[model samples]
Target chain A: MQILEFLNTHMDMVYIVILSVLLGVEVISNVPSVLHTPLMSGANAIHGVVIIGAIIIMGKADPSNILTMALGFLAVILGTLNVVGGFVVTDRMLEMFNKKKPGKSKE
Target chain B: MGEYLLEISYLIASVLYILGLKMLSGPKTARKGNLYAAFGMALAILATIFLYVDEEGNKLQNHIWIFGGIAVGSVVGWLAAVRVKMTAMPQMVSIFNGMGGACAALIGLIEFPHYFGHGGSILILLTIFAGLVIGSVSFSGSVVAFAKLNGNMNKDIRLPFYNIINTLFIIAIFAITALLLVGTLTDPMYVYLLALISLAYGVLFVIPIGGADMPVVISLLNSFTGMAAAFGGFLYGNMAMLTGGILVGSAGTILTVVMCNAMNRSLTNVIFGAFGTGGAAVGPGGSGVEKSYKEIGVSDTAVLLNYSQSVVIVPGYGLAVAQAQHVIHELEELLEERGVSVKYAIHPVAGRMPGHMNVLLAESNVEYDKLVEMEDINPEFETTDVVLVVGANDVVNPAAKNDPASPIYGMPILEVEKAKNIIINKRSMNVGYAGIDNELFYHEKNSMLFGDAKSVLVSLVAELKTL
Candidate 1:
């Protein structure tokens, strides 16, 4: 009974999320030509946000319980990894800009 | 009160993402764009923690495991990144993207069960499904892409039943997905089956793509991973999802288009062309062909340029690897001073990535109007007096003309072969990333000046001074 009541109240939020995700998928599929590569490279950088969010969520969880603590600890580790890894990857990608143009002489 | 604060932070992160994307659209501002994206990610993370609420409407307890996990993952990630070589960077990117998909899928798996059966919301189920489909595809597809990039996968593997098997696997995946959704199966056993099927489909998705198309495949898979992460975010009601999803979705779509343009194929053609089937065939070797020209020093090059009606400059990966755009710009300035009409011919997949050549050229302040795409410039090559090819290979190779057995036969080339006189600046006769020998080297109109791309160009610039 409790579960049924909860479902009825949250139905609107559920429908909204689904509709938004579907629309998001459609928009994602039809990206314009000029912005493709930059868009992908940029989005790869944003993936880092997941790591930080996961860390904070775990950090505030109950530490007294071993299972919860373990989950939180794992989250923090993965989160940090994501953050650091993401930055390193982004930096490396940016370094491609530093390459010399072919068929051009160095000063 | 705290939720409102989190919402504000989300708003800030969203703005950063948009700013980052906007800045990335042009070459001069790309560095600033990268930094903006990093800042947005940080904001999203901070906001997520602030808004997290427990079952009793109180703050969650301290989490030690999460911290420990973060510490370990950071160290490992740092070491892996620091030690990776530049030559292996593309493969490393594939591996890292695959890990992201795996992580998202795992999160959905662990979280969904807990939320489900106890009247778990549809949002949770949908998120799980999204994670499962996208994550699984990314994880498997990336592995195959990595294999191709590393030469572990065969460049020309065409079996009779390969396509049939791939079709069957895809069908099975959809069947299982339908069963899971319809509540026909109640056990976790089906979950594992679904994963296996999806994994198989991922591998099949990339196995038939030729080496020439690997870059496009990689970019497309990257978009898939981002979409998966965004879906996961939606399930959790996390602001990060809304921001990250929008950014990734937009970016992925854009990359797919760019990759398609590079090969002169549509996105659908790339995905469905499977088995090394669609692109141009290779041309006959120009071996033993008569060469009419002698190796000329930079002074000779400069003298010839003085009376030339028009000059076309071709840029390739060698430029990007050596970081030589500025020097090229200086050379262009010198030529333009003598009233030489110089235009740059940019092949779609000229460098390691799409727009790589454009980005490098734009960095050196090369005028946007001076850069011409493959289709727009091929016709002009016939009337071109001097076609200077700098560190480029396959895209300009004439083998696409007569060699049906060659890997690049049908693909449109820059028609540098059609020019009156061709000056190729290269270090050696070595093959390109596609591992095919160029027939353009032995053509009668072609002259090979072997040396480092940057050094040769510099020498040519110095020689121009005497003219």
Candidate 2:
């Protein structure tokens, strides 16, 4: 009954999920092919939002429960890598496009 | 009040994410878009750290582990992103995406036991299983894709009856997941079994795919990672996580479809076709007829290029392999100095990933406006005086059009043969990644400039200097 009650209260979450999917599709379909790599990279970074769930679980987990702690720690690390690495790499890629004049710099 | 603040922050974060993606569509606003998304991420992380409260109204503990993990991850991620070469961008994206998938899988692993112990609801259990299976598959599949892209694994490994076996494995996974959701399978050990099977499926799924199909595979796995993250969002009912996951999921799916369309292959064909197998099969022109090609030296190529009023360069993975981007840019500049207009024709699946040639050419300071997509540039080829094919083969191959018997038939190509003259710079008379002879090489209007791409461009630049 408690779980059922919880689900009933959060039915809006399901609606949110559906609407978000539609919005996401609409927004992403407009991206040109020239920006495909950067956009993919950016989206990859966005999904690093799983770091939130990782942090939440880590916060509430029993410190003595080694399995939970280890998994939580690893999740945080990997999620951070996804977040930081995805954005930075995307920025580096987009930097090439922002500079209009050729022969400005070379890597 | 604090809870309200946390919820508001999530709402703001979601808006910023949408704005970021919208801005990302344009070249001018793309960097700002990335920064906006980064700022949103930073806001979400900070809000969660300071304001999040559980059902029991307790603040998050384990600061040591949380901060330490973030520090280690940030340093490693930052250094890797900063130092990665433009050519390695595909594999780098693969590896980073794999990490995200692994993180989501780990969340499921950590949470499954707690829910099982408490006799959690079907919805919670379904969310956990969904996250676990999808996340683990994305993780392992992306790792395989990374290895394949990085040249660590070149050959496709297909077991006998792989398609049927894979189909059955997928069905079994689904059946087990259903049983678990319905309370038919109560044992906690099934969780481990499910995770293991999912990981194995991921490896098997990617192992049989050939190199040329990597862009599609990577895009598919990228979408898988996004969906896994979305499942994680479902578990927590977090708005920002859900929105981000959905956005990525849709974006990756569109990209995968675009990549597959470029090659004229369906998703099912890409997944099960195990293309690029059979080892260099003979093409329609490969046998029964002796095809002759004209070879031109550097000076002649330069002369042909210099006298041309308009030229289009078709770049492929071979260009990246030879690191000829900079020299090619030099060639372009020299040609422009002589009043010859130059532009690059980029195939959708050129290089290794989408827009890969653009990135490579951009790194050497090739203007983005000069990099034209296949659809737009194909029409211009007719008016082009010369089509300089540099380290590119299959995209310009006319077999994709004129020969139905060709493996690449019906696929859209650059239509470079429509140009007045075609000068293909290649190392030798070798077949491309598709392992088929390009009929374009034997066309009368085509002349082969044979050498390494970098050296060829360098010599051409030198020859142009004297002209």
Candidate 3:
């Protein structure tokens, strides 16, 4: 009975949980075609967002709270890292497009 | 009051994700997709912060630690990305995916104890467990993948009793997880140990896989990371997390299937075979069998194909790495204008990734029907007047058929050597990724046009125009 009540009150959280499970299952069970590599790379950029979210959540608190302040700082740092890393990866992928084929004659 | 603002932000973020995905569908728009996705993530992060601040500002007082961690991670990530070469991009990706999984697992660990108290519930517990399992596997599996890609891990490192050891480790992981769930092991130390053991199991799971199978392994690990992220989202009641996680997971799974098809191997064989170990061997006589095969020069190939009834072009990773597909397509077009029937023969696992060759061809607007898989085109090799192998090695190696000592023996390959004449574009008498000499290069029927794939293909196309 207590469990059921807990579930009702936390229905929104439960929805998140269920959705996550479904997503996870989808990720591991299927295969992807070549077209999806760039998509995956793009999605990976979301890691930066996660870092940003973690930062803001921690940052809005009182600076006097040293631990919270530390977490906020960490979030910012990680978020920056995520952003930079994602851009570098995207750049490298783009490099594949820039190369000229070998057969073109040089005057 | 601010709740509405948060909702609106989420909506915008979701739209960005959709647009980003759509843009990513084609090569030309891939850059736009990346930018859109990044922008959406930024929005999502901002909205999440707004909502969380409104709800529980006090609990998030550990901002300092978060910031410090972020700073350290960013510097390291930046340095790694800048230093890594493009050739090693796949390994870098695997490593990053592993890190993401580690982060998700760590988050779950930190929150698991909180849920154990009055505030804790079964739903949270399950989420935590899921995170731990997925994260641990992704972490270790990715490490092994990294090793394989970099050649740090041996491709032939299969243990005699690998299955037995793997079984034992899996059992141990399950048992520990069960104990933790049942409250028989509530200590943080125990949970940490469980994570460690699970990670070890993941490593073991991937180490036995051969280098040829690394692409599939990379895709599988990618999915694992997505699932871990989704679980983390569920634990925290994050909607964007769920959606992004689903997208990655589904995409990864599909890629794995495509890779399996390309290799002409089943997923079961890939997983259970611990691919890359000793398989059927090619015979000693295989190398000598092709001695009667004829060799052709560039001019000879030009002359022969000029009057050929039909021609097939087979491409491999060498073509992609050399960026030669466009030229090959051009050559094909040239042949078509001459009233020659031309088609591309693609061997599954021809390139670094599954469908790699296909993607390259597609990028050049090569006709879809001209792109043929190995199974569909191998039979045509016998009757085909000419087979042009551009920077492809192992896939068209006749040793796979006759050489019992060959590492790739029994692996299905295009019988390009069976054609009336075979012209192979190569740089040297060098072996392929498997590091073994190709006997097909010396066949009397096979002519080696030594040069870069792109350069040779371009010359061929140009030469074809003259003919």
Candidate 4:
């Protein structure tokens, strides 16, 4: 929460976010078509940071806030699944692109 | 000192994320890049849990729930990655992406009560509501996409007044969002009601789209998830979250455009509506004549392929369906032994998901260098001795170029007809996923080899040995 206030007060982070979005567009333009699916999955994983945000908000409530806790708990689980599954699957897919060898077909 | 450590780690994590994205551009560096990005996520999670403090300087102590949630989700994700077949990749990607959207929506839901509290910045509340609407839409839309792809639901479901309803629904969402922004809507029910409405709208948003256009849909939903997450970042003022979300949103937008261009469809058409409701017949459509392609025996195809100086193989969803990548790799090597130049022609939208065919071919151990894309391989077909099209249809259709009345008229296609000889393998005359007949199949130089892709390739391998 202090970080949130710190960010709003400083105000520069807002510009940073906007600038980052443009910089990101530049970086993404270079991705090859062969890696596009993995690129989608990889970007999906990055958004999983919402899990941390949910957990922080849940901390402000007392034990009686079941709905908030449940929502936060579920959010954590879903976010983790996205991040872990997305990266692992992308890795597995990339590993399959082994360099083929020269010569006759193996029997 | 502890705070400084936390901030440093986050900075490092962001750098790693950017580095990972950069590394993923090439085939060789992609796996390591994935690892680097995963490590970045892990670091961010660890730092947040251990170092989080409230604005009042209270340290966070909720440990068990967070750890437990992470553990369960990890197991589920791990099992999914290990157990899923390569052919089911599109649905899995959609499902995982849906989870990301769900998390963003939940954040908006959890924070709604506080949004009305005094001193809540109007900007923050607006960002929160953006997350709620976009996140709900993306989550529900992705679920529908998954169900349709998995055959649990019908592939295309159309209703009357699609464009009218879609436009009105979007306008209503904006109106409600504007109302909420003014702080006049006090009841929490309004928020819940908005979420429900948005979810329903999302379902309607996706059902009208045809299965052939799903890869583009999935990529667009991913961008929605990213945009929603960025709203959360704005709510919390977390630079890492904001950076990650913006990166995803921008990248996804670019990919959606790329996929749209590859299919030769405008983004406006893809979004407002396409397919489904139109009474377009799905067939070997409108070539006017009862065209029949020449049928070739396995021995003849083998002889032709054996003596050819150059052969380009075109692969599509059918190749993935039959799991024929390895056999094709074997055929390529066999032909190479006889000194025939062999290469693969990959259509951008070849499989159900973008880049999916490349992954499948890689699984079969096809060399990265041998795989050529449509733009680079189109000219090569003119000089090529033969083009062996495997389980591919709409991509190679000359109708995209010649038939002005065809549904897929303006779409870009592989110039397989330009090759000296074209031999296509298929189990039957059924059209491909686009539900359109391939004119390339009936071209004067084209011949059909009837069989499953795997069986035909296996026999071709055997026949090549004889020559």
Candidate 5:
């Protein structure tokens, strides 16, 4: 398969992926337990990167095929919603956790 | 040239994502961290659409569909984020997370033909199948979780020999996947069937999970979706996608473990224990005759709180459900105004999600310093004059310590029972979410105040004012 040939040519890139993944997990391990929900939510939004793949497929598909077009359209919509909603909601939730000014009490 | 540009851009985005996650660990810098990560995402998307090229160096051309889809989705997502209440945040998370899974599933659906008919490797197929099964399961399971959390479905359905049925389903899924890999099942029908079966299995995976364990379930499903996306990344050979998915998968798994430890339940038990299923599995603590708890009027509670030198308030899902965070904050203020030092005790798993109670309290503008974690404030309970428990149960239950037979025996609790005098507000004698009777209620120092949390807090605030 042509696919393996293409990937085998880019075998060095796999190291980059492995390093990035390890670093990402290492950093995330430091987050406190309290922020877990928002963390999960924010990560959910990041995986919305699938929309990029969707965009690629939608662009190249035979524009006349109504079924492929519709599926691609739905994919983009759902993916974008996941990304946008995940970030915005996590931000809003985190915003609620601001520290009060030390001297300003009884607000 | 275009490929290099795309990779460099993704590298930049990945660094920003890592930086954002690092900053999120600190409370003061969390909002900034979210912005950084969002900026990273925006960079990845824009760069991909504008620069990435096919083997033939063709870029994406359907500008209208891309922008239109994003715009519509942006509007919908913004409205949902703005309108949702803190108490219902878990529900919103479940629904949105499910969308991510649906995206992965749909991607596999679209690309299946390329893998089957076109030149495709076994590696690609492996990744594709992983995405298909995981995505389908996460999507359907999250829907069930959403329904349960939103109160649309209350029962935890467990058909006869549920474990055997699930095991068989899993076995069949593997067999079918093997057939596909071997080219024995090239028909699109097999993939579609696999998706359908996985989707059905997803529903079953979550239906048996009890209400209290929903948070862990949510985290686990979130990880499932993330792994699916990782497989999607592998399918496309995309670095940014792979990194992001791995980050989510690991983080979600860690959080689920933390939640399990908080409940003192093993991860295995959570998946199979079926704590809230029928029979004696429902509630925690003793199954013996109940002792009558002393009831205190709202006025007495107000007086007790006002006179106390130090007071600790424990809040739970009851506080969230009644939307009483604002009133409770008011009560804290009133007590502090009278020179009574008021503090809050927050359990890790209090309310629906981790740190949710903290968010709820913060929404009412409670000071961060006043909100104490169970580990820190738990010790101070003994020296405190009064411990007011608002809509909390299992977290403060002594049964977790004294009753080895209790399901939650090993879970670390708030130790509110150590305080000099204990006061609790609840609608009635109904057990808490763990469906367990709180032996703390029957303690000699405990005085139960009956009413809705919001109204009761309002009454307590008024009484504090009169004092």
Candidate 6:
């Protein structure tokens, strides 16, 4: 009964999940094969939004409990790495393409 | 008021992410697209830190822990991404994706005790467990993939009856998770035990896969991390995490499917078939015919290149192994100077990951227009004079087309055999990642050029200068 209640109350969130999936598929289908690596990496970076969850948990964590605090702290660190590293690497990859025009003209 | 502001911030961030992904479809706008997504991330983080308020109207207070973690992680992540070689991009992505998975798993672990200690709803419990198990698997699986790509684990190790055992192990994991859900298991240790089992399963799942199947495996794990993050979103009912996570999950899934179609293998076959096992069983075509190949030296290769009207180069992972990208670019330019039109024919599953060959070629300053995908270049091979197969074997393997019994038969290849002169450069007569012999090597028009890719290209460049 509680599970049903929760689902009924959060139907809006469920709709968001479905629409997001459809939109993701539609947008990603247009990417040319040449951009596959950067696109995959960019998507990888986007999922790093779980850092939001990590931050929220850390804030509510009981400071008296070392296990909870430690887990929360570790989550925040790993989440930051995922977000920052994923985006930077993807940008660096695309940067190669950005420079190609100038480099070609110089030749 | 702060709650509404935070919600609005999430909506804007989600829109920017969608726009960022849309712009990624074009090379001209992709760099700015990544910046847009980064800007969105900053907006969301700032909103969370400053605007977030619980029902008790209390703001987040652990400033030192929050900022300190962000500071350390950013410095390390930024340095690693900037300092890594272009050749190492696949493993870098694997490791960073693993970090995301690890973060999700930690959230599950941190939250599980609270729910269990208070007898929370089964729905909440289910989401937490899903995040924990899936996140742990992605984290450990990606670490293994990273190790394999980084050359730390060169050999694919398959235990006896691996598929059956792996199946049983996964079933047991889910069964125990179900038991916990139904209140049959009350111990908190079960949660941690489940995470451990999932981690072990991840390792077992990926350890048997050969190098050639790494693209599918990495894409699958990337999606797994996304699904785990989405579960985190469901747990918190946060729109930003939900949208971002679902987007990644779908993107990774589509990529995995595309790669599987390229290799003509299903996702299940890639995971459980322990592919390349057929390499040892059959020679080319399984006809037991005597196969012989002619060897071409540097000077003759140069002569062939110098006389050709148009040349199409097919590159593979061996090019990366030898760090021959720069030398090959020089060769391309040298050929162009002598009135030979040069283009690179890139197979879809050419290297360790999707579009890996493009990244390697681009890093060496190969013009963007010169890199042609398989669908575009397959027809041109027929009229081309010289087809240079450099550090590549299987992608050009004619067996994929004509040999039905071959493991890679249905896989679309470069069709280099159609060219007037087919010259393949390899270190020796070794089977490629598919573990099968390439029938193209022995074709009438093909000549084997054996040497390290870098030195061989260097010699070819030098020989061209002499001509």
Best by DockQ: 6
* TM-score (all chains, Cα) for each model: 0.74, 0.95, 0.73, 0.92, 0.95, 0.97
- Give me the displacement of residue A71 in model 6, in angstroms: 1.8
**Which parts of model 3 are misplaced by more than 4 Å?**
A1-34, A46-107, B26-31, B54-86, B113-119, B281-313, B319-348, B355-386, B397-420, B425-444, B448-467
Kindly list the per-residue Cα lDDT of model 2 for residues A62-94, writing each as its tens digit. Answer: 899888898898899999999999999999888
The worst-scoring run of ten residues by lDDT in candidate 2 chain B lies at B276-285
DockQ, model 6, C-alpha based: 0.77
List candidate 4 segments past 4 Å from native.
A1-10, A98-107, B117-119, B280-288, B463-467
Restricting to chain A, the TM-score for each candidate equals 0.50, 0.83, 0.53, 0.75, 0.81, 0.89
Model 6 chain B weakest lDDT span, ten residues long: B278-287
- Expressed as tens digits, the lDDT of each residue in B226-248 for candidate 1 is 77767766666665665566456
B1-467, model 6: which lDDT tens digit per residue?
89999999999999988988888867788888888988888899889988888779989878789888899899999999999998899999999999999999999988888897587778888999999999999999999999989989987888888888899889988998899888999999999999999999889988888757887888889888989999998988888888888888987898788778878888887887756674454464445667789999999999989999999999998998899999999999988988899999998878877788988888889998898999999999889999999888778877778887777778888888889999999999888866788878888898999999999999889999999
User: What C-alpha lDDT does candidate 5 achieve relative to the native structure?
Assistant: 0.83
Q: State which candidate, 4 or 6, has the greater TM-score.
A: 6
Report the Cα lDDT for residue B97, model 5.
88
TM for candidate 1 is 0.74
Q: Specify the highest-TM-score model's number.
A: 6
What are the per-model C-alpha RMSD values against the true structure? 6.0, 2.6, 6.1, 3.4, 2.3, 1.7
lDDT of 1: 0.67
Query: Candidate 1, what DockQ?
Result: 0.29
Estimate every model's Cα lDDT from 0 to 1.
0.67, 0.87, 0.67, 0.82, 0.83, 0.87
lDDT, candidate 2, at B197 = 90
Runs in model 1 deviating more than 4 A are A1-36, A52-107, B62-93, B116-123, B150-160, B274-313, B318-344, B358-384, B397-413, B425-443, B448-467
Give me the displacement of residue B157 in model 2, in angstroms: 2.3
What share of the reference contacts survives in each candidate? Answer: 0.35, 0.74, 0.27, 0.69, 0.60, 0.73
